[model samples]
Structure formats: C-alpha cells, structure tokens
Target: MVLDIIFLMLISSTSHVSANSTTVLPAAAAACSNGECQLRDECSTDRDCAAGLYCLSCPLEFRGSRCVRSTISDPFKLLNNSLPFNKYAFLTTHNSFAIRGEPSHTGVPRFTPANQEDTVTQQLNHGVRALMLDTYEFKDGIWLCHSFKGKCHDFTAFEPAMDTLKEIKAFMSANPSEILTLILEDHVEAPYELSRLFRSSGLDKYWFPVSKMPRDGQDWPLVKDMVANNQRLIVFTSDRSKQETERIAYQWNFMVETQCECFLFSCCFHLWIGL
Candidate 1:
C-alpha cells in the first residue's frame, strides 16, 4: 500500500508538471523585429501595442492592426474640399433607355431606336460626377455574356465601343480643367487582369484595385511604386464589415499619407454615413 501511494504521487507530480508546462501567461507582447513581432497581426501603430510588442508607425488616420480611424467631418473634404457631386459629371451607356416600337393610339410614346445619348445627357444634367463603365464583352446581343440567351454572340468582336471610349477620353483631355473620374468594374475577373486591359488600351491614368492599405509598410511598397511610376490608378476598396472598414481605413490612411487617391465603394451608404 505504501508503494502504491508513492506511484500515485509520482503520477500526480507528472500531471502537474505537464499542466504547468502548457500554461500560458498573459502579459505585454514583445517588440517587433524585422517585420516579426508577438503582436504582429494586431500591430498598426506603436500606440496599439503593449510594452513588449514592437509598435510600428501607421499611416494617417489608421490606429492599429484592427485599423481603427476617426471619421472625417465632411465627405467633401475627401475631394480636395470640393463636393465630388458638384465637380464632375458621370456618363455611361448602361443607364440609357430604348424605345422598342411606334407610338400607339393609347398615347404611349414608342420609337424603334433607343436614344442612349439623350438619356445619358439627362443624367449628366442631374449632376453625376463620375463614370462607371462595365467592360465585359456581350454575347448574342446581350452585354452580359453569362446571362441566358447571350451565349451565342460575342461582344468583344466589335470595336465601336472602344472607339467611342477613345473619343470620350480625347474630349475629356481637351477639357482637362474638368474633373473626370472613371470607375471601371472588372466584371467577374481578378483586378490584375483588368490592369492588363487598361495597359493595353493606353489608359494607365485610371483607378485600379489593390489589396494593400495605403501606409508605409511592407505590404504597401508595391502600391507606392505604382503611384511613383505615374500609373495614375487610384486604389479603390470594397469593404462590407466594420472590421474590414477598419482595415481598409488603415490602408486608406497609408495611401492618404503618401498622397495617393483612395476611395471606398460600399453597398451600405447609410452605414458609412453613420461611421
């Protein structure tokens, strides 16, 4: 019985040692080193860190790894103290309306041809400050090839749209004093692929998508380089969550620090206003 007690004690002691070995103490994180640190994932600025964790400098407005930033008092401040809505006009083909048939005796106005330009002009008169173009090829008389009944035709085979864009660009170039903001959607492909298309079209001075936040960090060096190279592409991010907004804001702060143009595209305009 005495020998059994000794064995039990030995087992208990072993168990205690194992438990102690696995126990972790919560304390201040360590300083960052060579882009490595204890709180690396959570580190945005030195202020976000505890005693041991290395505090890296965050871009303007960004506070921490969680990417917290204060809201601007005015959305117009984002557009160089000018209202984006007032400074430019938006033009697009998607919003154009078509008239399918002749007017009937019932007094419904009908026409055979769609007056795309007239519709766009009306929108321009209403104060649209930017243009968003959907560049996907249409198939079978459908602009969206993925849709039903569009599989038989290819839209990219046509050149009229490209020519039209060139004319518009030329016109905008002539009126350089007017602010011209162009928003391009990639239509179901990675942004990098769209970058190639822009390059091929000689449109390097447009906005492109980036995965990095606009701050002076390892992740943003490429974005800085692109800006330095006069790529003329602004970084636009689409964020859906508060956490994501924080992260995007941090990156935006970094971009803002570098004087790069950054914009956010969100579905929840109301929520963004609250923020």
Candidate 2:
C-alpha cells in the first residue's frame, strides 16, 4: 500500500494576491472575523479561517472554497501501533518558528516574512509532528531567524530559540504518547551551544540518542518503544560536525526527501528514511 505522507513547506502565512503583499479578499472579511471561521465557513484567505483550517479553492466541488481542516490524523493510532518509526509518516511544518504576530525581540520592526500563522504550541496541538526551524546565533544566544546571508540581523530575528523548544518540551510532557521531531537549519557556530540549549529547555530529558540511530538503511526503532521509554524527541541538524560534537543526528544522513516544485517560494515533499 502507498501510504500518504505530508510535508508542509511554509511559504506565506496567508494567501496573497501578489508576491510582495498579502490582501484578504472581501469575501473573507464579510464571511467571518479573524479566528472565528470554522469548517465549511466561506473564506478567501487563510487569515479568515480559524486555527486548524485554511482557505482552499475547488472549482468542481462548490462555488467557492470554504474553510477546511488542515490537520493530520495520528498515524500510529490509526494504523499499526508497533511499526518501526520509519514506517510511519509525520506532518512536517517548514520554518515552523517564523510565526505571524510574534512580537519583536530586538526593539525594531520585523522585516522578515512569516511562514506560519500559528504558535508552536498550536501547531503541536494540531498534530504537526515534525518542525523545520532555521536557527542562528544572534544576540549572544541561538535564535530563530530568516536571513539572506546565513547571519541573523535584528530585522530578521524572530525570537530566542529556547522559547520554542520549551514549548515542544511542554507539549511532550503533557502528551506522553506522542513523538516529535526537530530538523534544524543550523547556523550556530559556538561549541556545545545547542547541547546547552536542549538541556536548559528540559528537552534533553526526552532526547533520542544518536547512538540508536540506524546506520545502514535499517528500520528505525518501534514508535511505541520510543514513546514508552520517553525517548520521543528526535533532533536533526544541518551541520554535520554537530553530529559528532554535539551528539545530534545529521538530517541528511538519516532522512531523504522528495520535493515537488509548486511555487517560487512554496513546495511540499515526502520524507523517508535513507541510507
């Protein structure tokens, strides 16, 4: 059987009529107030829809697109309960930390774009199991950012990375049966900084040791086992050296992706275990 996999690559927080500006259509404004739109509610943009829903257009189904649930079912709960971790799929959110309406931390207006409208907690609550974060060294600590030159400036900085990590830790603590993954586009240069962040955020408590990672295209450990042992958090870093130095897994070594081009900035893909 061909299992469906979803890899949500964030492009814009909401639908737009132009590449540089976002405008909510009149239909959305007239249909519902922000955060009030529910399933089947008429919407012209994602901002007009409530959390866990997005505006989508279907020419054949109805006259106009209505708010629809953008959620994923827990594969483990619906499918096999004891499958290898690789056998299951996750709803992966790209640039999960670049959230709209996030307050400025540098006392300057944010000049970067937002990729998501929901908070990290909300994403987790909506069943997003994997998060892709762009991390950089900023303001003497690691921060989430979207920069042009791989260096985080005040205008590009979102928030301190610890804030989001702690949110993940809290979610896992409250939901003991869930597993989460973090894929980092790492830019931190300091030694052991990520290690320190993980520890301080209390996420280290659920750390999946790199030693247990498959090395020869082998199936990952059973998801049930990972959850039962409380080793439910899997972290992957872009920097290969960090694998040995920080004891975090290198993303390329463990996961393979097949992406499809959809737009200039947005795309989706399937992630699979790789040799």
TM accuracy, model 2: 0.78
lDDT of 1 by residue, 7-41 (tens): 00001011112111122324435534344445433
> After aligning candidate 2 to the native by TM-score, how far in Å is the CA of 128 from where it should be?
0.1
> Which stretches in model 1 have alpha-carbon errors above 4 Å?
1-115, 119-127, 138-161, 188-193, 206-275
lDDT of 2 at 192: 97
| True lDDT of residue 221, candidate 2 | 83
Count of clashes, each model = 17, 0
The sequence of per-residue lDDT tens digits that candidate 2 reaches over residues 1-275 is 00122452211112222123232434333568577888777877889889878886655334587787877688878986698777676687778888878899999999987777788898888788888889899998999997877899999999999999989988998999998888899998999998899999999999999998877646678888998888999899999999999899998776655544444334334444444
Return the clash pairs for model 2, or none: none
Candidate 1: 10-residue stretch with minimal lDDT: 1-10
Segments of candidate 2 deviating more than 4 angstroms: 1-65, 265-267, 270-273
